[model samples]
Target: MIATRKLRRARVLIAGCGDVGLRCVPLLAHRAAAPRVIALSSQPARAAELRAAGTTPLIGNLDERRSLRRLAGLASTVLHLAPPQKNGDDDSRTRALIAALSAQRRSVARGATSAVARQRAWRGWFRATFKSSMRAGVKMHAKAIKRPSIVPDRVPGTAARPRQIRLIYASTSGVYGDCGGAWIDETRPVRPDNARAKRRVSAERQLRGATQRGLLSASIVRIPGIYAGNRLPLARLQKGTPALAPAEDVYTNHIHADDLAAILVLAIRRARPQRVVHASDDSDLRMGDYFDLVADAFGLPRAPRVSREQAETQLEPMMLSFMRESRRLQNTRLRDEMRYALRYPSIHDFLRDFLRDFRSEANAQFTITSVPVESPAE
Candidate 1:
């Protein structure tokens, strides 16, 4: 279990509690102040794990207004790791939460009866306030929530007090979208040519706007490919999946999931809002080199290489396009500004460490399962 300091203790809410969220849960729960930790996930099974870990788990839709409002009231800090919504409107959920907070602030400003009465009324009106605020937020984004499958209907109440909150939105380095082998940093100009990259760029801007508007102390961490125990790409390679080899020219960056999580917690403690950080290891290896490492780790056959022309002809259009660009990410900002360091600083280091553990586990399981069964005595 990771220990936490008293200073870092604050009511923290983790939205979109997937693998990453679950990994962070123990860290938050171990705080010295024992800050109230709330986790929300649409999947009951996912929430159940958090509940077992002594967290208050709520099954709620990230896209629904009321769910976000309830979440905002309980948490002084929010971490967003949910998948982007369909269409171009990825900020809808965050906007809804902000609107709910604004309404609560307004209610407080208007002196809604007595403080005790207001608190009681806010508690009672939470569900309704969430619905209205969400609608208003969707409108601001020029999106009709009704068309989406995840959007919820309005529920009829007063907003709660708008408490101070900090937001850490996980983003992707794919925003750079292959910088043609050029080294890039937080200061690098983003020229996102692909649709996914373009959307990520837009999302980053929206997050910055929230910071500017004082909605929350916000920061963005543009992460690269993340791998860890169960989620590692090695497992897929071990299963005999053919690794795609695009042009050897397209370089890729990667970070261990543990390192990424640690950086997130570090950023929270540092409180450097409106900052953009790249969460990547020091090495930038080619895509083929990455797959080769995976193949070696799993004792699998080496991936066949193809000429650029053949690759373009045989691979999917999207895959070919992805292979066309190469970018090297520099994490100087994370090191100098955030004063952070990666535990797994190179792909080779990460692969070696992971494979060692994996092989040990495999050996142990084999030994356990290979024990000879005793013949039944007649």
Candidate 2:
């Protein structure tokens, strides 16, 4: 109960409070002792939505260093879901945030030192020390006489220890580039092939750099394709885009949206200092096969299959960028080290529930809209 109360008093901040961050709010808020939740939003228009969902939203832009000044010493736990600015190799935003946090830590350190010095220099210091010594002696005497010794949880001044903010950053698995469909773990060296993936690498480096300087403890979660009922490629499938043929197909990974949110919260709470883990599920389907499965579930026609050579012409460059990689990620660290059991262990399991809810909602909407209006008191 005491632990729960302590957690309730904690402040957690979510940067880039989009779909995933919003989903995480209830998981923390509905606990026996709810913690304070704050979300960062670049758009002021979203403040009302954030507040409605029980999170206090702070408007700030990552690109503008001046805007991030307000985030100093704001929360003890931070989920950094914001992406790097486009068209840049370096993530200046993350660097700016780290600088702000370092400044806050230094300020707190100075204050703590001053407080200790003032206490030692006080006119009543000797008297207070004598009283404290006497009280300890009396407690020891009482324990020696009639009770087993019990150690105190913490010393008094220790309670005023400087706060340490922990950060959990969301990165992309594309940093691995093409792995020839081989099974790779977090230990594998990153070899990003494109600028988009390179940007993620830059962000990862920034956080690790901050970790090295004792600015913060951070965890990096490398993610693959993220899908939910609403986030799926249903529209692309409907557009009749061509996927690679089975013989030429590339393997891909995925994580359900809710599972990703759960992983983020888990990382925030349980991540080791400077740890990196993959946020991928157990599904090991080829890219084309995965699309076919979803299309079948939705009763839509499957995407047309073409050889890689043919697909180059039919598919957009952005879509082709995804197909160029074929790597299976090993998530042993996520399971063994962090001990996070995936709620949606596979894409199939997620699709089943997602399709069920989607159909039900569609049916309800159709029923409401299609109902005929009757004449009033005819």
Candidate 3:
């Protein structure tokens, strides 16, 4: 009887409950049904923080497979916000997460407690306690709530729904690589140039194949630069990190973190199967101009600009790698299909409003005029 209820609850599991994932928790309850939110954390230390944020914390490491068995059949809707590990061309973390989520129900059968003795002495007891605790909560969430599907009225793929677990993956727009500053959509073929993007491509491929095989219904959301009041270019400006000059600056894309959190919530049901949507805003600005906007807003000095040639010698490899790629994303699908109206439509729009609280009217005017930006409409 308890096992049966487990199948019903655990409605939404947020794999990576970091800043963006934390932002997603309340929105999930607000926009959709108030399904229980379970957060998966590798560190047990974060259990308190996760609980404080109104999510039931389930300790499971994506790097380790055994710890994830409890996650099997735990959530009907999964928000995969976990990123790939650093220094890899493939996302082993995603691979493990998929394996665990798709694992057989019987893999974690009762009376498995004794099995822990076979592992290394130091870590064995911990793994044993972890899995046993998950078993203790096998009754799942108290009672299943009435679900409200996030279907868009005008979207074509509403009908013919497949009965499978829903997985909404937060993929990066870097998968498209450099488009020579062209206005591109989802139809553009992916040409991942960096190891970072290659991992994302691998994740996309795995999700699409999973959907095809009916393992799970996956929705891929391609996101660009995510910024919020807390997440800004303040550090770079303070460090005086150089940006490319106007002549050599590459076009950049952005989506406010709050807006992104909202988009993820909407994509839970509105997004089509194996579909990709850009969570980008209509901010048509160069990299340097963007720095200037933030600098002016907070009354900070703008970062020094260097030409592309000079940047290679001055900037770190990571910064230079970002400078190499230049493309503008089209978010028509996000607006039309998901029907999500942006709360912060553009970086400029957000900065303009932010300036109100940041500085005086006289200073705000100076900030707006300080940065010269090109018109970019997504």
Q: Which ranges of candidate 1 are over 4 A from the true structure?
A: 1-9, 109-163, 235-248, 312-321, 362-378
- For all candidates in order, the CA lDDT equals 0.65, 0.77, 0.77
Residue 172 lDDT (model 1): 75
Model 1 residue 327 CA deviation in Å:
1.0
Q: Tens digits of per-residue lDDT for model 2 on 147-186?
A: 2133232233433445677999988888888999999999
Q: Give the alpha carbon lDDT tens digit for every residue of 259-348 in model 3.
A: 998988889879999899999998777788889988887778998988888998997776777788899999999989999899898887
Model 2: colliding residue pairs: none
- Judged by whole-model lDDT over C-alpha atoms, candidate 3 comes out at 0.77
User: Runs in model 3 with CA error above 4 Å?
Assistant: 1-10, 105-163, 358-378
Q: Pick by TM-score: which candidate is best?
A: 2
For residues 271-350, what per-residue lDDT tens digits would candidate 1 score against the true structure?
37888888888986887777787678767676667777767666555556557657888998888988887788987887
* Candidate ordering by TM-score (highest first): 2, 3, 1
Worst 10 residues of 1 by lDDT: 369-378
Question: CA lDDT of 278 in candidate 1?
Answer: 86
Report lDDT (Cα) of residue 177, candidate 3: 86
Query: For model 2, where is the 10-residue window of minimal lDDT?
Result: 369-378
